[model samples]
Target chain A: MASPDAAAPPPTEPERWRDLDMLLSRPGNLVHSTFDPSPVLRDLIGSYVEVLVVGAGGLGCELLKDLALSGFKNLHVIDMDTIDVSNLNRQFLFRIQDVGKPKAEVAAKRVMERVSGVNIVPHFCRIEDKELEFYNQFQIIVLGLDSIEARSYINSVACGFLEYDADDKPVQETVKPMVDGGTEGFKGHARVIIPGTTPCFECNIWLFPPQVKFPLCTLAETPRTAAHCIEYAHLIKWDEVHSGKPFDADDTEHMQWIYSEALKRAELFGISGVTYSLTQGVVKNIIPAIASTNAIISAACALEALKLVSGCSKSVSNYLTYNGLVGTHIKVTEFVRDTDCLVCGPGTLIELDTTSTLSEFIKMLEEHPKLLMSKASVTHGGNNLYMQSPEVLEQMTRPNLSIPMFELLKGTPFATVHVSGMAESNGKKVSSLRKLRVAFKGVEEASKMDTTESS
Target chain B: MINLFKIKGQKKEEAANSNGGPPVKKQSPGELRLHKDIAELNLPKTTKISFPNGKDDLMNFEATLRPDEGYYLGGSFTFTFQVSPAYPHEAPKVKCKTKVYHPNIDLEGNVCLNILREDWKPVLNINTIIYGLNLLFSQPNDEDPLNHEAAAVLRDNPQKFQRNVQMAMSGGYVDNTHFPRGGGGGGGGGPCYVLCFWLAPPTLAPNANHCTI
Candidate 1:
């Protein structure tokens, strides 16, 4: 169902010819204008071209400029935060006067001023939990997000709506096939996710996890001074949460004000810190450029969306990352899905049935421990201490956990005991644990012999 | 034809008399192209270009930019440019000769600007590249970053970024390492060149002359 405002007259489309005339007639237009006079611009006129750009940062603005220049009719930009004075450095869409302004609004206005003929709608809202109706109207969605959470959410939403075929079979899968664009400093990536067709983000999650393994005490450790703590909180923590706030112009400005306050708090606190001496300045400036690259990738996603909507190119499901600094090296790879995936695996959906409730499932698991064993048997060591089923044991013994075991017998009534220790005549320690072996006859005979010996 | 030969001989004689150095040769078309690009460079007033080896060698030069804004404002930062003879066909090698706190520039001054590397094309001229460099000084991106710490700081605290820049320019310690004098250390016993002169406030304490080489 459409939102109440869906019926409301959509924002008035910009007068394309008026702006086009201005651009063409501008004095320096000949030198600045890079657009080719082609039929593409004429074809796009008056069409309700809906686009969803997820980021309103640097690359996002550039993409908007490109789209407007290319003559796309309708545009929507979604971002959660406002412009800071620092954003004026690389976010060319915002000027010093535009500091503390909502980035989406500033970007939309700039786009309108630079290139016209499209309806620009700025949403100062987070991308997560956005109404599907908002998504359905757009022919293409561009993800100019920075974090994995937003990227994953966008991917999930796309997967739920779009269906792709693999080997001519209609595969029903969740997690929409979408493009994820990200940048960190000067490096940027544009990844396309098609559920069941190409690899999902999860397939390549290991490539860019939270932290890489670093040796302990490899670098100097300094106490978090008040100023340093405040600085850390302002730049690293606040923006992360604030960037996900709902779409409101005032809320966006408040977030910028909060950032300013955090900066002041850090200065008052005087937090001293250390970092890799070589890269401090480079890191600071390059990051926004990288974010801008993400925006470009997001626009590229729009191009791909056009392809998908127009039945031009095959819907891509591969992942691609670009490192601009190293060279615009676009690394594209296919991601294979894990059959045993916890989220999208077969029959793994958590149905809202009487037996599927958390309490009921816990109770069922407690009552039928054997079911746990059956699942555990597929894993190694599950059968050793815990009574596991044969199915699990069979699965565990396949190459990865192929540890050999010996069958040991006790007294007369010999009971078969599986032990991991190897038999040694020299009696040397194996695996740093002392090993001892003893043979016993039949159980009844062993018991009688034990009794006789005791007597 | 006789006058042309005489003129050529006179040029040879002039070349020999000057320094008995290599004969003055006309610049190739490519060199001329690069020369025009460099000549037309409308660098920001904050940016100044110099040839460390002298004006005769335009292929190798340095650019010094004193940012008037952002976290690096008032700090004198120098970047060395080594353009190959095949420049325009290849991106120039740029290094941050200044040690400052930045996310995209490493301590060694190896910049991560995309235009200088992956995104470079022959179509891009010296003017565009300089603009990109100046943009870096004015706005540092924290999202896609080489210096994670600097990026994190810029992303988290713009005010702190300002403080760090001020501290670094004033020759104070940022974190622990001393901010290099004028963002350049006294390396190889080279005399420090004063890139820019600023009138210190009357109340501020007087100190040694601030110069950057």
Candidate 2:
């Protein structure tokens, strides 16, 4: 046996790179590679892997790193905006030299240099209404967008075809699946949407509608001053520089101040208007670490996709939110469709006349004033009157108060009446002035006299 | 000085003379495995292991850890560990004896580590669990938290969480509750009682600094 102090054999650098290179060269080699077979890979086979990264910002870059590390062969990144010096703070894929370059191009180039033998395609285009055509090329779509509108559009497009059917129903069909990543300050959330199976972001936010639809514009539009813009840009740059890096107390405090100020400005305006400024605040408060969290979430989503394709874990029809700051809390909530929704409601028919153009429809509305009469109004209860549509009126009438309103409107041409003193009626108070078309002896007599009454 | 071997020899003689068939030759396999696990423990330098019932009973032991970093710095925390006979296969029952202000750790000392719950697998060992516990001190997760107040503070104002932890560790009041001697498990029984005080409430002066063991 060798002595304890005997010179140890020279350490061997792990040949993991060579093995990885070999695996990359051979498509079939992925199967035999000694690297533990991911439960995700059991499903992803045969087809050329096409991934579309929607936001080439902080989270987008981190996700790119994770994807490249995981050995994904084909990657496509799309972002309309060019990189600014401010982005250097948290957008890891871009460098100081790449300040003026488009985010997508710079990120893709960075990926090429860092991870060889992978095909990365960069697109400098906005994912607006024309996203379907662009999105069709990719097998998977990952959203790192800040706006809920963009997220909703992506979600709707990915899950279903926007084309109207014979019944005028938007043919809800899955095109490409998507994953959504969002962050609020240090906290971050990642959710996977598998078309109809999973609870979409809309479904989850529907219960608490106001929380998701806060009135604020992007920083760029509201705070139009160049100084504010530059300041905001600086915040983004700070985040980009510190991407995937730990922050000290000073840095955290500075970022918190910048973000809180930006938020105050954004709340005063609107989110879209102040995009650039708010982007700065969002980046400072929710980049690098949050982005890293999002990357992990995106990777998990990719794994879930692989599992879904492989039939390991059956299509999970629920939204999974992973919160890293609070110790990896995972909440899976199911989505239930709202039957009474005006947009995606059940049994509600939408028949779009093929010959009518949008402008022509507007002209028709202007020409026929009676079409506007679809909304009829009635006034009741002298003072505290509130306006409501017929549907709301039908729902609000109680047996006791229902008779007086009906009696007052019996001879009127209006289909719906606005009820005043609703607060008092709701409070069970007796009112003296009973406004009516015909004089009634009392509420009991009015109820008895009505021919339409169902006793 | 008397040799330990001689004393053992005398005990064997006494046992043999008292009509025992034979002195028990060696410790059972269960005791042997427990001893090995205890001996091989790679506890941190800041952590100390003790047996309140003396060194003979390895089944019941306590681990004291004084974290040197993060919000819980300068705090002395003790955890009791009761290992079952089936040990490695079954997790040891761990209870925090010190009160800590943390999102993941409740007032009752219940922890929310995934390894202790659904994510636990047979492959994981005690070292991994201990490291995970240490990580909880370094970084507390606010989501899926046992203490909503701590979680909210951690989520809304991380600085406040740090301050609260510091105040609690220094044997001061946090949110109107006094910090226990070990952190959480000092007062034996009652609705509420001063942890370090030896005397009843009426006898003890309010200003006295009680440091009873």
Candidate 3:
């Protein structure tokens, strides 16, 4: 060895990461930090910044490892999923033997095993299962979920932090920033949502393509493709033969029954293209997940987490779309906030019949185009107007659900009503709170409107 | 951290499976998870979930969403879900049973929610899909629509889209699409009808004038 004392070969594998570390105290990037630079940057990142990575799938596995390697010690991950036989390609953390185990717990265990001094608390439960207080514990939230609903759910959860003052201005201190990353085949995006500061997920809900819905008539009459056959078997045939027994998608025997029945239906309709995977895909709506796509998105998310916690660099303005399919292309666009967003913007306006009961008002939310809430619990001035969750509270509020709208808001004027309940964001159920300006049509206003309508 | 970007060729469908098929030998992880989701369903008061075939058929159920606001106010849109035993791993096939005029929804009841197709992931539950269906009426997307004509109108002439939505909900014809009647929150004797429709406890009066407030 030529000169044993010569700079120690740049600190070797694990420790080498400390050399160009953003949070390292040795003054590489601390010179330009926007906020006051902490003297103990490494310690701040490790002990002070609490990071939460939602989802423990392909990208989740990568995020855990990347975050661990980047010197963050206190990490927590929550995933309402278990490892599947198919997750092996991109979800490197899991092995063949670890199938059917919760992703979060296993990911935490695996990461800690590989990296030293990192304590990851893995909560193997639904995002909704956790209380609002549980989410408040994290300093930063990183998302690596696949479903739009999950992303939207987490997005709304983060945006839910924005509390508006009397002037309709967001309370700055309550703003929660979320780093969201997603991948589709070779296309992926990493976005940062600083509740009040940046355009939220709901603000840019238009960005996502509308959900896929098959026409019922096609399934009912003009069956043309493999999907139609699968649907016919699942929707009609099973019910005809097995009146009281459920057709389980996970059951091999049940699936086989559907597959065969679908084959017969396909033949009957002269519709071909029903394979096992197609059966699974049509029934379960599964898309083939690629390992590499998950990796690229995960890395982007990991860097975002580091930037968010360490304040090493400016966070992504709002959104960044990445496409690796047609030669690597990354585009950054600043999506403007929707001023009338029901989730993160000013409260929406609602006009209702003053005499309508509280129960009727709740029903109206489902029918209302602008406020199609499937379920809701209302509150005014800190008093629970009605609660739709938790058996005990639901029972307590059951009697009040029948109370008329006018009686419920006796003292309030044409003011905004705060409603809270479950909303589907992306394709996931997220707890959402919205502000709706309720102006009940008193008998006089209703008659005036009726006259205006007829004329 | 996986972004559930759908594979291009992949297709999706939702089903509240029939309680008829081969006897479920054992509950898979997906079914177990689905059970948890159904048990913890947080649906709106106006929405109703019913297993028409009875308790044994958790797989096939009808979820009705009655929007009480927006253009579709007082409209009841029912969606049938067929849950596969492979749920959580695969999304349930969902279809709109009601025919209405909208940008994202076709007259045939095809929906355009990403989660039901390419964006679906195993972590999702029935509750999420139900909420997704709820979202369609509240904020109908004009882009990437199944009803291209409606989407075009929504993009080019929003006032007209509103009118169309109103007509569709009232059980009328919108551009040759004959919609069924009822589900309309008509302004005529509005409060009276709201009272009559809900079948609330007989003690309640139909008119707001009699209220104690």
Q: Which candidate tops DockQ? A: 3
lDDT of 1 by residue, A336-447 (tens): 8754221222211111221122223223332332222112111111122211212232233333232212121111121111122112224442211111111222334555
Decide which is better by TM-score, 1 or 2.
1
The Cα local distance difference test for each model comes to 0.49, 0.49, 0.66
TM-score of chain A of 1: 0.52
Which is better, 1 or 3, measured by DockQ? 3
Q: By TM-score, is 1 or 3 better?
A: 3
Name the weakest run of 10 consecutive residues (lDDT summed) in model 1 chain A: A213-222
Off by over 4 Å in 3: A1-14, A20-39, A165-169, A244-247, A269-271, A346-416, A419-455, B1-213
- The digit string of per-residue lDDT tens for model 2 on A191-213 reads 66654334555444433222111
Highest lDDT scorer: 3
Sort by DockQ, top down from the best: 3, 1, 2
Q: What is the DockQ of candidate 1?
A: 0.01
lDDT of 2 by residue, B78-127 (tens): 76777654344345656555667776665545455555433343345455
